[model samples]
Target chain A: MKIIVSLFTFLICQLYTLAQVNQASMYGLDTSFLNYNTCELGAIHEYFSYHAKYPESTMSLLKRVQDSVVSHPIALSKNGFITFRFTVNCQGKASHFKLYLLDENYAETIFDKTLVLFLYDFIKGLNGWKIIKDKSGQHILNYNSYFSFQIKDGKIISVAP
Target chain B: MVKLYLWLLSLCLFCFNNSNASAQEVVVSKIDCLDSKWQESAEQGLFHAQYATGYMSEEWQSHCDSLLHICPNFSYIWEMKAMPHIKGGIYDFASLNKAVSINPNRQLPYRAFMKCIFSKDYYGALLDLDSAEQLVHGGGIMDHSFSFYKGISYLSIGKADSAVLYLQKDVAEQSKRMGLGNEHYNSLFYLGLAHLYAQQTKQAERYLLASIKAYSKFPEPNYYLGILYLQKNERLKAKTYFQMAQSALNNGYNMNEDNNIYVDYPFQISAVEIEQVLKE
Candidate 1:
């Protein structure tokens, strides 16, 4: 009788462990849910610092403007990534900005007109960047960047490296 | 007394067995739901695969490849694969044609419609849409996606009246069924285009704005906004929208190429026809 009882308890514990394993493997734990605070602005600043060292020639300026837009400025408190592409003309005028948020949770919650407008204004302000002309002599700049952010304890954290 | 005890023991064993079976059934059901979740994840992966750059990490590619291997006839996976090809300026007529051929009775018509649109063969696309409509009618395979594409195809062929009719119907029904996703936004977009083509600028503006509201990330609304601005002689605004469209297209957004839709008006464009346009 004692052995039987011990065996039953062992079976129950085994089943519980199996259930947990299934749950963990099935729905990935949200790592961004953990508390971690880091600022994306530091990385952005570093990028710009290195970029600023490039010659202010037409091509270099065009690249600088493109880099600025691609480096996402805003961070969210979730595992999210955004990509933006834009062009700065030969005269250092930013135009044709496109931003896309690829995070499902962020898309549902954070992407809104207010945020989009803010991003647009930010890009437009960098109108002083240089541009490179294509073979057709059309001055255009293009780039893409990925940024992830998380918020913990009511404070925003940048988790993108 | 021994006989009575044996009977009681049998009864208890029977009841215990039944309860255990019920518990097992519940466990099975939970397992099924878990399996369904995996399938959903696979579907999402396929959807994103369409926009994946050619330089996909080995891990991501293997994950998607495993899903495709398990569900070879999954039409969405094939469709997703076709998209990156189109975006990267690689035309895979064979894969797209196969996708439609394999699932003619399914949502393959939508894929066929996209192929025809990308190729700038509006007439061919309309024919495919007609076939798709027939299949739906034959067996009651009612999906708002078909009507959405149908409307766009009509608009591309310069059939503004038909476009409006189909898209308005789609919008009404989709809204009722709460089908407001990418397809819903598209229906709204083509409806706006139909209005613009019909010279109803006020109505066009309303629908276009509604489309933008529905899915701001969609480039179609912004593209039409540019056109609307051009019509109103707001060149600067128009230029901004056009630039937005161009940027969106380059960054993995699929553009409908029916009727040679171009970021810059009067300039012919196709997903893979960028090289030709650039040359010109």
Candidate 2:
């Protein structure tokens, strides 16, 4: 019994150490929860600092959106602004690809599919995120991102970085 | 429980060693433009394999033998390089500038503009917005403002006349396209306010009333209409408009309502701006 316990303890420690292995940064997200409540969702969304060191530019993410709006001008959709939150685990794996949120009274429609596809494909095609770890260097964090779009009357007027 | 814990621990140890050995590192190898691959991808067209690289795209005879993983393109590589510091869906200024410098056609500035707007960095957004405008013109010319952002950015920067020029164009074009939709009402409403701030009361009143006609539930036009009546010393009319404004604010719902664009745009009215007159 003692030997087994000792072995188990050793295994646990080994596992913990592995989780701490430093990873080179990469583009990913932390989608730990599937049905997050509103408050939880808001908090998760706010977790990322708007401006941080070595920051990413929005150019690659939002250009096509701005172009669409300019090419075909419309207004805000019935849903107001549709926000899609993509979460990836620290291992550079996609945890949640299509987590979408919308205004209080809006209904989902076919156009939303297009929006989701664009975002998913864009994210999947992206490469070269270095690595992510907490201050303690513990491999216990996930990266997150939220992209929002405002479409109305079949017009995609605005998209956010 | 003991076995499971032990298994987890062993797995963790193995994983730790594995990660150390397989850690992705930036390849700082040099590229020789004289190489055939380099000329083909980097010079011929903006091909992915030529100018960009990642640790994963490690080709033995990589472009100029840089040992660099060929990237999708310069734009993607630049964006990926700047991805470390990003949070909250907003981009930092430095990275934004870099992205634009590398690829003028990419949407870096516009992304920065949208980020700035959310972060309430109006001045920063103006700079990005202008960059976006310039880039668009570089490739193709647009007769209208960059889809209301120019006008909104101007208004946020407190340049009402400049805003009026853009907003007026948006209001006219958008109104024609949507036929009094919420967006149309919103443009009209802002144009009216822009006129009001510029002290063009007549223009302000006309647009404000027009905005109100287009969207009855929108509280802004009513609130501003009240201010307009008060400016004319029509106390009874002003008082009526104010009551209507208040009623609109308390009302059930108009999914398409307009409010201030900054601090409280298309949502909540600025009590401070309106209260000054109410105090009278």
Candidate 3:
């Protein structure tokens, strides 16, 4: 009985440590919620920082890929928005991916695990991100970037900002 | 040496006093309300909020929340707090709706603009803009007339006929205000798009040419005109416009709107898309 109690306490401590891993940054960024990976390097700026951009204008290409890749399941008729938030380092590599799902009213919601994982992998595989440049066209900086997808009846209707 | 130190100290004091006076002036010049005491508090709150490093930072949110605690009915504070969330796609509607409830005339146009641009809620945006028009006698907001935004919102939701009506009104109003042939390039571009989608190809061609004439480097209208020409089997004209669009995009010309930093405008095209058309 004594040995079993000690084993239970050990398990509880492990679980508590796992829960505490997600802490807020100085900027109050929720660092670990639904994060696919947590390997951010150096300091990062927000996507809305001055003159940030992707390497090229290929968002329509991305939309085309999404339309072709996501196979619709009849059971997955949920309509909402899925936001993928991540950071691109100064070298333009993306990491620290996070996901948030919301209904039309902007309330938090859930999605199918298969759909979520597919999106996670899709965002993770995206490359050729560009580092933000200052107005003078000098000084490269890392920044966070995000894109949201509007889904209707298991199909992506549009992608935004 | 002692005399030089004393002079330096006096200069420092003068500079500090001057800066402090300017800070106070900034607050006073920006805020004015009927109640003097409330106005003072509001100004101080705004001054402190402005010191935060980034608008989307939690520090900014907390400062806005603290000010709201004291002046719960402050509509501008609610609007300011909602901005970062909207841009980030966090999508909290309570704060923005609260602002609209408090001061409809001042806040409704702003809410409509955000809904149309950031959230892509076309129906919701139309409702808010309609309210704003009734209250403010059809004034503009965020550098666009209500008819201009309504036109875009209608086009977004596939209502081409309504888009044409409002866009025509916008063109007439803007031409009356800014003189003939001086309407905004965007108004003309969108009006052209509406005509194209409504199957009026000749009107589309006229306004699209007008858009490119107004702003030579504009890319979207060029690409659409290429499509229109391609459909008519005018491959040579289509290729010229496609190359023009590609060249403009390569030179970093884009939808030159102020809010595009936060969101892509509806129907905005890209360099890759233009290239694809050229290949076709």
What are the per-model DockQ values?
0.02, 0.06, 0.25
Top of the candidates by lDDT: 3
- Residue-level lDDT tens digits of model 2 in A39-77: 122222122332211122342234445564454433434
Q: Point out the worst 10-residue segment of candidate 1 chain A by lDDT.
A: A39-48
TM-score (all chains, Cα) for each model? 0.36, 0.42, 0.78
Question: Any idea how many clashes model 1 has?
Answer: 3
lDDT of 2 by residue, B1-280 (tens): 4344333323333333344333222111233324455434432222343244322222212331221133323443344333322223222333444556767666555454434355334455566667776677522112224645667667755688998887787776665766655446667787888888778999999888888887787777888889888889998899787777766756732325221111123223533334545677
Candidate 3 residue-wise lDDT, A1-161, digit = tens = 99999999998787542211211132233344225434334456787665565543435744664675556542347887667676676566666556667766655676666566566566556675765765687656668787677666556656667
Best by DockQ: 3
lDDT of 3: 0.72
- Lowest summed lDDT over 10 consecutive residues: which window, candidate 3 chain B? B5-14
Report, for all candidates in order, the number of backbone clashes: 3, 35, 0
Query: What order do candidates take by DockQ, descending?
Result: 3, 2, 1
- Stretches of model 3 off by over 4 angstroms after superposition: A1-41, A55-62, A69-76, A133-140, B1-52
Candidate scoring better on TM-score of 1 and 3: 3
Clashing residue pairs, backbone N/CA/C < 3 A, model 3 = none
